[model samples]
Target: MSMLAGATLVASTLLGAGPASAARPPQAPAIPVAGLADPPAEFGTDWHDPLTAAPPVTHPTGKSCEVTVAEAQFRDFTPYKGTYAPPRGCGDRWSKVVLRLDGKVQGRQYDRLGYLHIGGVEVLRTSTPQPSPDGIEWSVEKDVTRYGDTFREGHDVEMLIGNVVDDTYTGIIDVKVTLTFYPAEKPAATKTATKTVAKAAAAPDHVLTLQDGTLTTPRNSERIVAEVYATGSGGGCEEYWYLTVPDAAPYSCKAGDGPYREVQIEVDGKLAGIAAPFPTVWTGGWSNPFLWYVIPGPRAFDIKPVEYDLTPFAGLLNDGRPHRIDVSVVGVPEGQSGWSTPVNVLVWQDAKSTRVTGKLTAHRAGDLTNSSTYTSGSEHRLDTGAGHRLTVAGYVDTSHGRVTTTVDRELAATSVHRWTDGESTDALKGTWTDDEKVTVDGHGPAVTTRTDRTYTMDGATTLGAGDRLRTVLSLGDRASVVETRGGRRTAWSRLDDSYAGDATYTANVPRDQRHAVGTTSERYRLYGSDGCYDRRLVTVQGTLTGVRDSC
Candidate 1:
């Protein structure tokens, strides 16, 4: 299948856009259909019944798998693939779609899922039943009511049951699908109201505000925007500066081979902050742009936003004097590790806000090291650094609040690879692992902290049928914890967490095309009897794919 692009709203380019002024964003996906007061009727879709093939027990593996499978494709050079666009559909909608994958069908991995596409747009995703005692032989029912606007008559709908996680399996399977349509009893109606909050057009004589005006025009407020993206094919492991948070931690870069850590920030030539890992999935990845563009992950419903507590800096920038600011990144130009980054800084101001003017300190395409050689004979081995860091700097007054600022940055990563028959095809198969860790703390005029934090982000393109991508992680005691005044480690958790599963996404495209990539993000939370800490947040509106080439 082909690769999938985000909708118009998700992963949109912020460059040249003015400050966010709309009360209601145009990207919101709200369907017009009324909720079913009664069970709706089903419109029989198409499918192959009567057991075309044998179903899987714990699913199937490599050779045992039997089904029309899909795979993840690897890439080397960066193709200027623009963001994904949805297909133009008939003026109609559906409420639901029922997908049935019989037990007789075999697939590669259960962790990853297959995708269903309609008219070239992803409409549904299917799960597997392995490792789970029950739930096997069960069917998956998805609510497509939201995307009702994207459906039409004679729409080309197809199902893909294979994923990149199983290169070892030439899986096979059978599929069946059904759709439920709802005819509006009456035409839907919408209401719109606009409210504007007036503010003095003049800044306080004593207030000074400085923000990065690249992604978005300067804004007046206590808000910040940061990002990560690639501009080139990332020779090996690429790096780019995101933002400078006066100083702290929550991010890291890589050390060659693969995974890496946060980017460090410096203020006034001093270590200022560390970039924390916060995912831009919701902002960049959506289900269906127009209708059901919601996050597929229950936990990441795309609501748990990332923000840095810069209120403490409010008092520092009150001096009215212009300050200097600079940001940079590091890494190799390899696969989808990471590349050119764009950062937008927002420091809302009144009379209490000051200024930050500085030079772009030590900035360059860092030379990531590649040590620890791996021997790939009978069994392949890897021993190389996987992470690195970034540092942004600037000059500004001190926050009068002197009140400590508390912020958390979450980090994560995932990847897929395929080692050809250099040794044995299965000997060195592809793997994809995702991890989340955070480093939370506090910093300000009253309390400035210094620490060494880094992260290694792993990204890869979708796997083609027979491609392999498995998780490869070796965490140590979640050692991402810190020692506060009390020997107690604060619990870093998903505050609004509803789902914490593996990184999974599916799309339906041309059989000649490959889509779906693996990516990870991490976070940090401070834990002290008296809660308070500091950290920086960096998000990448970038692509997550390995080289678009095969092993």
Candidate 2:
């Protein structure tokens, strides 16, 4: 019987008259509270009273009632049905006990809460404090209380009961209470009547079915879906499974296996899945293929065969510029050899479109040379030798001798490309259509290269202007500006990339530091790699004067 029933029995036995005052109505059932008692082992063989005496009934109000009661609750089983991470709902069966005063209802509480084991680790506890108009029949309240505890296989419940009451006529009260055991609902192999009721009213948002021994969520529109998959029960045999909700309807539960039904599915604070009830939706599950994540790009390089010798080259080719060796290749997918025949080369600065290519020649295993190139923008050029040529976009840098060359356009080359003796002489091919932006050293070039061959390396000095210039200097990191300046020789304050106070920036070169320039002759150092005849040349001359970055 429910706890409220017991309260009504006591109240009816004492209040012989029909209910009167608004504050004191016919007694209502009370919620149970914690009542577990220490076992017989704690008391030993000593004989004792079956009922423990109730303490004096004391309240803030001076008036006192004549009777008292006590109650305890026990659980036969918990409600969890499967090994779920977060147990979804309450179990199928539950019962409670209540004790109350003979003629009045004081206060009540309930304990012995229980629920299912989730993931074989957590206990899902659920309780409902209900109210009833008729003392015999109970009505479930809308509000539900739930909690979790660690799951233990052989768990049981125990409690003790005691209470006290005072007499309204003499200020003296009698107390009597008993401990009772009620069978708890256990998880059944098949659904029970009560279980069916809970399922019909509180079904989860998902449902699952195993096909060919493989589990799959057929599809449903239920707002709350409960899917069950059985892995190895014990002894370590395990399996994996998943259920996907393709779509959702507000406050609805949809499933793959059945017709749409209204249900509520909540994950965290937000609605994760919902669907409309009745009238099945969607013919079948959507086809979503398994996807592989993109792998990380390469970090280091193994050299490719890249070299050219314009030893026998002639002047004045197609662009009116003197000819030299130019070579190029398209990006080949991993494990494939040779380049793609370009109908049109697509050059892109982003990592997705650009391809990296590198070549290194080794004198021996330990001693080697490395040249690497990153392709940028791509275009189509048909006039060279092949049907179409990909644009030459990125700069090529070699490590052995610091060989660097910037390719601005597509150069002409043959389609029958091959490496013989790990060496090839082919002119760089492709269109120069995207070479609109230019940078000297690392700094932006405000003026076009055509407008000024005299480029600023950093924001400090100028390079080639008057022939009698002494020391030329350029400085900056990769992203900013480069300046250069030079003038007739004088003991001028330091005025290059370094600050004026630097020892190298001395007001005058100390006698010991006079060898800073490392030059006494008029000869300039040929600043070219083994591949280029002449690229950059550094020189020194008489009458040095510091020229700042005016341009």
Give TM-scores for every candidate, taking all chains together and pairing residue i with residue i.
0.32, 0.12
In order, what lDDT does every prediction score?
0.26, 0.17
Error of 1 at 547 (Å): 36
Instruction: Tell me the tens digit of each residue's lDDT in model 1 across 1-551.
Output: 11111011110111111122111112212222331122112101111111100111111112211112122221111211212222233123211222223333333322233445544434443333321111122343333332333343344454544433345432333344444333322232432212111211111111112344212212223323322221211212231211110012111222343433344433334333334343222112212111111112221211111112233333333334343433333233234444323232334443454442222223222333323334444433433333323323222232332222333333322222223222112111111112222222224222222222222223222323444222221111011222232234322211111111122222344222322222222222222222322221111111111111110
* Candidate 2 lDDT over residue span 255-299, tens digit each: 222111122222122222221111100100011000000000010
Off by over 4 Å in 2: 1-126, 130-272, 275-551
Evaluated at residue 451, the lDDT of candidate 1 is: 24
Off-target runs (Cα >4 Å) in candidate 1 are 1-258, 265-271, 276-324, 333-340, 348-373, 384-493, 496-551
